[model samples]
Target: MFSPQPQYNSPHNQGVVDGIISGCKSFCLQTSIHGFNHIAAPKRHWIERLLWLVAVATAVWGVVDISLGQWQRYRENPTVVTLEKDFRTWHYTMPAVTACVQNRTNQDKLQNAIKSRWNVTPESHPTKYLYYRRFVDVVTSSDLYHLEGYEEFANDPDLNVDLFELVVELMPEQRVKLSTAEQITTPPKWTPVMTEVGACYTVNSLAITDVALV
Candidate 1:
């Protein structure tokens, strides 16, 4: 992020600055002297004295300003540079963090509400809500997948009501332990129905509240 022209701390570097000023002064003096060559006699002391005085004044002003602590403030205060860096960072870095934190906040709020309503902690699990949102966004993207068939049944409240009935039926057996030491489980066969159901489950788990539609 280099600026086209120098601005901060100092306007110009010493090398080009002093050299150009000196060169200009020399050229002016030479031109003046050459002009006077045409004159039989001319008073040149006044012009030389004025130029020397102006140059000295400029040098003294620079020294005084540098001594007074104006230069270092710009040096020490990176806020201006940081402001630039932040502008760039926001353009590139902030959206992902924002989405993640937002999802986490919503998840926490939802979990708390569920606990308060149930008088018990709902099943404790780590759910990446942002990921679920991304998956849902992908599935719903019309250009990517029409997904129209899924959406027809996806919004059904009666389906959720029926599923909740199964949960209600199993509530009595909730306390029982199903794990047995010798048994192992393999992934279920990936049928089309299973894929749709799994996607729905993932989407639902991460949602702050279930949307019921018919």
Candidate 2:
């Protein structure tokens, strides 16, 4: 009788099965290369936390930089830009005027500076609006003009200067902010104050101080 000895599984086969099981367990613990799976939660959470921190820090730095006024570049040139804006706003509905200015303080070197420094004639309107407006405001100062002896020309230099100055600093300078008079009604609170007889005044009394915050 030929007895067939049952073939016994070799150690090599057993080893191969063990290796496959170990590999499968390693893949599960680390990552599944071939199937849809989940990433290790701890590593994912760490990355998210780092990103959130960086975002918050960036936002805080941005706010601080703006508050410090470190980014201000054109702030110094405000006088010119502001004057232009006010000119456009005020004259939008009204007819524009020609204005002239002479240096009252430079009396010693009058004729020389008048020729070199002054571009516009005493009563003639300059072509440039910005220059004309500023010249008018400064030349028209009551005291300054009085010294320049141009007071004979009749115009409201004082009132004009005050208004021009007021407009220039209205937004940035606290002193020039719109007065309480501005908020109350349509018409302005104070009219141009008249000097005793014929002279012009620059600024008038505040009809509305309520606009200011102490």
Candidate 3:
């Protein structure tokens, strides 16, 4: 008669099994996903664990269903292009155009404005003139990214320059005419608007509050 075989459930084997179970429990507790902890808890009843399993399955199914529906829709209608024969007769609105002048500021006008406002010329008050010039450069320069340092000048009403007036005073005198369908039409009025780089002018702008018959 052969001796009884040694038991397969050795201490080392049992320890490895326990370690796996402990790792799974720790993962369930620390994970951000909901319902996993309830399923893994040792004190939870069988019925409660079953309910959590069903809930998690339902949520996963919902996400998968929505993904499939979107994919089907894309496959059905990938893209559509329609061409019109009489496209010339169709009415089309003119596109708005914004223009920024190369010469953003006029030195002569700035000097005059500063002298008129403070009653002091650059020659007499060199410090004050330099301060104003620095403010203007910070506001008008396109390369300067951070404006936090210039908050004082930006917030001060006394230092603020009339950007629109400065740009208009130096604007070159010119006439604009529009022609459409071999007929002369009046061009859209240029509206003054302040932008990141100082005063800019826009034509056929919807931002204008007062609607005009063009």
Which one wins by lDDT: 2 or 3? 3
Cα lDDT listed for each candidate? 0.37, 0.39, 0.65
Candidate 3: stretches off by over 4 Å: 1-84, 87-90, 142-184, 196-198, 210-214
Quick one: best lDDT, which candidate?
3
- lDDT (tens digit, per residue) of candidate 1 on 86-188: 4433322111100111011133244343334333343442343333333333332222234553454465353333333222222211121223233425422
Local error of candidate 2 at residue 182 (angstroms) = 16
What number of backbone clashes does candidate 1 have, counting pairs of residues 3 or more apart or in separate chains? Answer: 0
lDDT of 2 by residue, 1-214 (tens): 9999998989999999999967755654576442212222234575665565466567667889876563363475656645656543342222222122222122333323333434544455435434444444344344422445344324734323343333222212112223341242443222222232212222233521322211
TM-score of 3: 0.43
Q: Which one is best on TM-score?
A: 3
lDDT of 3: 0.65
Ranked candidates (lDDT, high to low): 3, 2, 1
Q: Residue 39 CA error for candidate 2 (Å)?
A: 21
In Å, residue 93's CA in model 3 sits off its true spot by 2.0
lDDT of 3 by residue, 27-57 (tens): 8778889877887878889999899889978
